[model samples]
Target: MIIKTLVHIPLYNKATTIVRTLNSVFDQNYKDFDILIINDGSTDESLELVKNINHHRIIIHSQENKGVSATRNNAILFARENNYKRIAFLDGDDFWCSNHLSTLCALFDKFPEAHIAATNYQLKRSRKTIDTVLSNFESTEDQLLKSFFHHNYLNSIFTCSTLMIKPEIVDKTGLFNESLTHFEDIDWFVRIGMKSKIAFSFRVTAVIDEIADNRSDQVEMKYRKLPDFTDYEAEAKNHLGLEKYIDLNRFAIALAYRMENDIRNTTLYQQKINLKNLSLKQQQLLKMSSLQLKSLKRTQKVLGNLGLHLRAGD
Candidate 1:
């Protein structure tokens, strides 16, 4: 029998959460799907736990520590070879609600022209659940490229785990860029949006566990060491025809650099963007701040004390 959908999970050292993720997949209301768990060199007991699941529908592939992008690309290749019509992703540390797959499948059925389908999701941070909508728009709608660009910049509407796409679309759009250690999903979404329309559902049907040791946190630390926006800038102009928003992109990048205390690049990008909203004095203050490493640490400490936190885009 031909599988209707394939759920691709890229696993690492997620021994704590892998079982929950698999159980969520098995509990899905949509049953016409198979799972591909790509174990990316997890030193933990993640693989052993997965083997004990005793599910025929699950296929496990183990490879030496390739990054998330490469692991996902491997799953894409597997989906193609298996003749699956649709493909979805669920990370080892993340899980879907029972109706998540069914919701996306129904959206595809309703809007055959849409190559991509996404739903709302919740972020679980330190025992708090925050429900997030893709955009401020209505609950269900078919979004065009222009609308998507306007509503989002770097981060996508939904997280990677909440997205479903047709195999043909993947063929046309190509695989995820293995070079990008972060924001690969953003780059992939931008490419997909440029090629086809997207169907979105406002129902929160997935949960992202934003733990301290997650890849996003590590990526933020890496950004502090070295920040670069060349790839994003090229994608905005070359793929999405978002030349006008280049300055906006620069502004966002500048903010990221500022948060990282990389004031040199931040000031460079700020000057290049030259946003009019900031008064001259405010701009001067930003440019002239000492930006000492100790001061940045103190600022972070203050924010933590005040219960303020930062979340990555998407």
Candidate 2:
């Protein structure tokens, strides 16, 4: 069958949650799509379980461990080489509601000029059992692009699992950066916003499965050495609100290092941000010493356990 929408999934040691994730795709209300699963050097039984599925609409491939950047870039190349018109992403540990694909298709139909369509998703944080979507804007093209960089990742408006893009976007925005440790999607989002019209829908149609035995969350932010968004300085200046977006990113990373007591790296990113771009609360915390920030973070963690959730990303 000619696949119009290629549902690309990348997997690595996701055996515990893989079946649930795949079933979410197989059960989509939108039917004109094909499944492409790339197993990236799993030490677990993820490969065997997938092989047992033996579904005709599903195509499976395996390779030695490469980071998510390589896996996603491979997915992009696969979509283009196979002549697929639209490509959607679903991480091996994430899931979709029945209407996830349908909603994306409808978004495209509603906005014919859109090269990208994204739906909001509920984040399932592991311990707190919190389920929420942090959407602060409407569906306008400008808002869709701005929603992503307007806040920190805790309040991010886009996830690969909720996005469907035309294959042509690859030519304009380029592949996902392999050098990025965790924010590869953020880097790609800026490029896509610069080159394409991003259409968005407020309806929630996906769940980010952090509650599962997720391997991706194993790494620490301090060890990863995230970028402070200086690379996009030129782009930030050209686009309205982009400078504040970059500043917020810098603040988030700097705060991460601050929480870890990595004073040198914290100062490195702190100097890169403009204090005016941050919220009053964030600005106040920025002035706190590393010890103060660590204590406050600990208090927040305790409160989270008690279900006294703060407004996310505030």
- Which candidate gets the maximum lDDT versus the true structure? 2
Worst 10 residues of 2 by lDDT: 305-314
Model 2 alpha-carbon drift over 4 Å, by segment: 127-154, 297-314
Can you write out model 1's per-residue Cα lDDT over 1-314, one digit (the tens) per residue? 88879999898888888999999999999999999999989888989999999799999999998778899998888888889989999887788999999999998888888888888787776678776533235435544334565544323467789989887787677888777665566557656766677887778899887763454544553453222444455555454434423444455445556667777777776776645633343344355444542365543332232222233321
Where does model 1 exceed 4 Å of error? 133-146, 153-155, 223-253, 264-314
Q: Compared with the true structure, what per-residue lDDT tens digits does model 2 show for residues 215-247?
A: 443466554735567778888756666777667
lDDT of 2 at 268: 91
Candidate 2 Cα lDDT to native = 0.73
Q: TM-scores across all candidates?
A: 0.80, 0.87
Best by TM-score: 2
